[model samples]
Target chain A: MPVSAVEVLDARFDAEPDHWPELTARAGLRADWSWPVLAAQAWAARVPQLVTVLHGSEGPTGVVASGFVGPTTRRHRFVGPRRAGGLGGLDVRAPGTSAVPGWWFDTDDGHGGVHRLLAEFLPGIRRELGAGVCAALLRQVPEEALPLLEKRGRLVRKTEPLAHLRAVGDRDAWLATLPRKRRQHLRRLFDTIDDDPTTTVRTGGAVDPTRAAELLRVNLETHRDVPIIPLPQFTGQLTALLARPDVFTIAYTDPRDDTLLALGVLLDHPELPLARHWSALPEDEGGRPGLYFHFYGELMRWLHDTGRPRVSLGKKMVDLKRSMGAEFTDQYAAALPLVGLALLGLP
Target chain B: MKTGIGRDSLRGMVKTGVDALWRTAYRRVVRSAFATVPFYRERWALGGRTEPRLGSGSAEGAVSTEDLVRAAVDLAPLAGGPTGFDPVRGLGGLLPLARPTAGDGLLVALEHPGARPVWDLPRGWRGCLVDAEVDDPALPEVGAALGAGRPVVAVGPDKALDGFTDRVPGGDRVHRVPRRTLDRLDSGPYGVLHDPVLGYLGVLRDCGLWHLDWTRVYARRTRAGLAFTLLRQRSPRLVDALVGGGVPGRVEWCPRHATPVVRTVAG
Candidate 1:
């Protein structure tokens, strides 16, 4: 039988039952979207944070984090990574602008429990905050939360078309699903690595500090257009992530001189693998042409062999992700004033 | 007694509703865009606007698509319109634009006569037109919408219309309107700036934590919708996330016209 009542508790995330890893598993969270991962990212960014657990009559159903940015008097809610629409302190409280945080929920309630939690829990927070928040915003939430939000009358949505890969069978099976042109392109990339003994890819091992440092080095090189958290903060976050058994680094090396040509990071989750970050050396640094292509092919192969279902490259790189058989959606954020939404009695 | 209206049935109903919801709204917008803005005008509207295209790091109308499918999901209409264009107000109009879009549908602001300050659309939504006519005298009416009360979407020109003050003491604003012809067909300067039929929706307060705003979209315009959704079905990450979430619904994209279809999945 299902429990009729659920409770929301404002507590440290490390509380009883809904503990890290354990609750994450129970909630069926993905690495990038989960509270633990997001909190770590937010912490690295030095954002203010708080946690709330949605406990059903039986146990905890969902756990979400509220990251505060801007002045406390006019703070906004932030949910996921800063780049993925998570709020930073600066963008908060610009006149007429509200914020939506990145958030995740447990899989236990079929996400219905998440809605109940939002409906009951969010209002409770409004009163607690005192000055009162204008509205709650969520970005890049999947179908799970979308439908639940749709049930509300005033829903604002923007699809985020993300790049992902699904493994039906081993490498060959995966390639077969791609467009013939794309398949041919990828085949050549994979064949180039296979045929050239000089270049090799490595996976399935803990990343030592040295390798982690190299990953950061390459990251700075390629992600100029995108934002990177402060190095010390990122390094700290990377060390914690590397400590996890499920997270691993993928490194491509030039065999002749053993130079680190390109590096990518993958966070293994029960649902699918998450491509957290990656960077490659410039040509002079031994970054060979087609290294990105080769690494992705190799990564797909590994996912197939390991029975991992899919991989998320996060946001951006639309055309490239599309050619690799990826679909995209938009992410939207809305602000509904607490006093009005409740008083007006609208969804 | 057990009813036929089980969770699966409810899921089916919602999926059907969602399918109609996105496509219906999309078609209307696309139809409106194609009919209202002439090809020559799109160039003018496309120019002068400078917000890095809305999605995936591309500028709006920056990378043009030749594929028929990509044309259907074109977001240029939404992104480059006016800086002040708010989807919040437009969101309500979507249901009434097409048949079968569920919810308490919205009433077009024009439906009401008189130089009214705002139109009270369905579901407590307010619509405001920011144009030359707004006077200091109408500040209260404009302020009422901008004031901390209900969700309002105000549309206007590059500047806060000649007379209206854009400042709202307590509103979650998302933009600055720039000049552009969003609706050439309508003799008026209907560029997105002249409209706030879309405004900011507030943050969602929580039990212990507060969450800010969130919105969802199918595809940014000029991207191939059918191809993308088709690829989604084959995607393991998507399949797992969708199936794992246990929402009994599927988005069936029509490959030919590249349309949206909401399907109810069996539990």
Candidate 2:
């Protein structure tokens, strides 16, 4: 007789203390966005309806956490909240799996056991979500996991653009990739606004809570007349993330009046690149030229000078990102079944 | 036996016309302010003024345009306060002052049945003519004029007509001019503006309309719609703040061919 065992644990917000280290370690195993504590907090506030967990084998062979919001209806699709930075709904990350789920798996890490566990456990997870589940939308999966997810379900490919520079690569080689005119324009932009000591960039390990709240209030003020739902939610989520040690803040300051021209709150994922929350304020003392452009240049250069490898510009401002030399990469979203294949045929 | 006034009389007439136009515009501004802004509403209430009756006298004598302008200036501090950034707060303060010129244009065009002046139509792929005679003068006051009782037959820009129906309240009568029919009309005022902006203004001009009554138009922009909803829900106090906050004296009209033509018109 062979001994057999499987253990599944439902993780709550407070239980994070026991599971955090393991979750963080597993996050390190692969470039998983959802496993981060900040992602967990975002899900909690924005889409609190879905179940989030730490699923694994008896003594912890694997770990997966997921969330869902909105009623499970036949015609409805699982869409990520409007403000979600990456693919909209149902994100999964396990050891040896890339943030982009469709790529080829790297077999060097002996991920076969975890892969087997995920395959066996996913059906049960589907059953819990209900029968109308369509596809499991995964985004930013590394090149390795693509084939694995395809083997499990139907796959679709899309390109997601990202702006990155290597912490240790040759700067000249990186700059060579940009179009000549664009490269020259970027250089000019830097040169044109490089002067003015009044504009200084400051980077720090953590964000102050009071300052975070103030920043959020000001952001709302700027867009008070515009109507959108996700902004307020994003502000709340950023405020919470500011209190965490893993998050950091970079500010472009106007030394003359102590005004914050632009502030970016970034989350450090030592296993991958840095993710950022960005906001800016126009510098006008009685309707004159402001430091918005100058501050932005200073901040980007500061990040370059520091060892941070890349910056996720996130959503909106696609044209601006292209001007800055960001390349487009594939990002994907999928829906998962509660039971299995039979549900895929639902509308 | 003179169809119009003589030269010496014409100068007097011109001065009177100028003064009348100025006064009418100012009255419209004030009326809109009192109707939309809560601070003005409160001011009127405290001054023992009430609805169904003019501020203290007829529409002309009750509140002078100068008084309305001063009120707007006084209320400028209220913007961004309790009202957040609602445009109504700013516009309400200025409506009493600006409405005379703004409102007169509409009223004169609508009240005169035989005066059919062909203005430039909104440009671009979509364009239509505005027959001023059909408009209802009372529409602004009652907020019920978006319906077909207004006389403008729009030609070309079928989508714009469709958008009007969807966006305007009681917009069942706004009919689209078939492409064949538009080719027959003299292309009114080409090269006036560029792109969607030109196209938009062309529609307004061709329609023979200058100002928009936001109370009747719908806003398609989700953010704008939400802002309007929030403003409506929190009126008066929010209106007061907008007035007191010193919002600029600018009017924001809804985009033409937008789902709702007049999502917001702030003065």
Candidate 3:
């Protein structure tokens, strides 16, 4: 018998150590997907019933990424990843697909084997879901997977805009680019507080874990009036980041009164040149004077002064962020074909 | 020696006067009810037909304090009940005279002789009541004149009622009240009694108002000290955050005399 077979199993993180690595290899080998990072992210999300495993014959050939059923209301119906400008990507419409599945493989040799492996395994999982499965939404899908998914269901293309900011040279150089009026406003703001004998902006090392937790609590409370999906696992991830030295926390305070008006945590990814997991005090609290804005500004200045290349001012606040001279980046998702569909459509 | 004793006596008298003034300031409330108000008089007359002793149990055989007190207690059920505000014909007995439309979307107009017509309507999907106090008595009469149908009233402001009336049978009708009479009822010393009763009735008219959409309300109150009855509703995470003793996102404290203030996590 020919040794051509692909197996799909729903496995947990503890069940398979090499599962993530295998998936990444296959994604890179056949479709340029990043499955490894995605698996880590999914694990971090604590999404129960994570449908993932290694697939191949005899040995691992590719990784399969899947998640539980997630519902979207009429309000959040528009939420999904999409292609924008020239950036080709997939929008995870099914409400639970990962942005970066981090599937990587050595494609230097050939694509036939890996493509066959993915085509065979994708449908097997869909069949397993059977009538229960409606449609699969994916984002940042590579071009190769498009032909396969098109055979399975309708592909609605859309464009999603994402904004980003790049930290230029020292703080002054970054500030120099701002319109003179804005720069003057910033200067007056800094000077107004600087002159106040009681007010002080303190720059320091990693945020005290206790204080970081407090900032998170405040951030959540400030938004209590607004409706949003709760992220229960965020605290654990935040705590983990706090434990690392690379993570920096800054506080704006009235030193005389020993009152902390605002605080922020910036996760410095030196290799990636972006600040990850950045959140601050909500703006209604006098923004800069309120501590969150002040701390964010101080943190940006520190990064610039320390020769850090760039910072990722993670999502939202588009207009204000762009005014501060931050550039933008695009995120993507993709869909894969089910085995039966590919086999039926094979020419 | 006698003069010193007299001075001490005078001081004691001043102290007693001051105490009386303080007590009156804190505990005294001026309460008045419309005595000549046509609605009360007419309602009382109707009530007297069944109960001959209506409004006669107290001094001067007028609607006495005791009658007012009894009416207050009996009026509780009239708030948003199945049988509209049962027309109380006698002083203390309530009679189910007319059956108002009983639907979630139906609006009711409380017509008072010589007072602005009060329309108690449903407030969107939230189940609360939004009250529009139109000075025009014609408005309530228009609504009352409305047969069993949905009618849209074009509400405009003018000293003289200037809206054109087009009646569509089986359409919602706009109830109306006479202007001069509604003005008298809405004003005068008796308004004190009328306002609270109207507010209470309005509260009852909308069932959701009593509960106050507890989900969002309780979520808002989780951080505050407002008391609420916790029924077996879907447990929102906000309640969990409040009772579970986790770190609060923000702590808001409103002093009795000062403005409300919020302290964020960074503060």
Worst 10 residues of 1 chain A by lDDT: A91-100
Give a tens-digit lDDT track for model 1, residues B1-267: 996687666666665675677555444433333222222112222232212122232232323222211222122221123212132332232322222223332122221223344322446444444334433343456455444443333344334432233344442432222222212112121222111222211111111111111122333222212111101111010100111112233344433222343233220
Which scores greater on lDDT, model 1 or model 3? Answer: 1
TM-score, chain A only, candidate 3, equals 0.58
Off by over 4 Å in 3: A1-66, A70-134, A140-152, A157-159, A190-214, A217-234, A251-260, A282-299, A302-308, A331-340, A343-347, B1-267
In candidate 2, what are the lDDT values of residues B1-267, reduced to their tens digit?
A: 767666666556555564455335444544444443433433443333433233242221233223333333223222222322222122222122222221211211111233223232222211122333344343342224323243332332344445434444554543333211111222333111111100111122332222222331111122112111112222222121212112222233323312122212331
* Chain B only, TM-score of each candidate: 0.28, 0.22, 0.18
lDDT of each: 0.42, 0.36, 0.34
Best by lDDT: 1
DockQ score of candidate 3?
Answer: 0.01
Return the TM-score for each candidate structure: 0.46, 0.43, 0.40
Off by over 4 Å in 2: A1-14, A29-46, A49-58, A72-121, A127-135, A142-159, A168-180, A205-236, A282-323, A336-347, B1-267
DockQ values for all predictions? 0.01, 0.01, 0.01
Cα lDDT, model 1, residue A257? 77
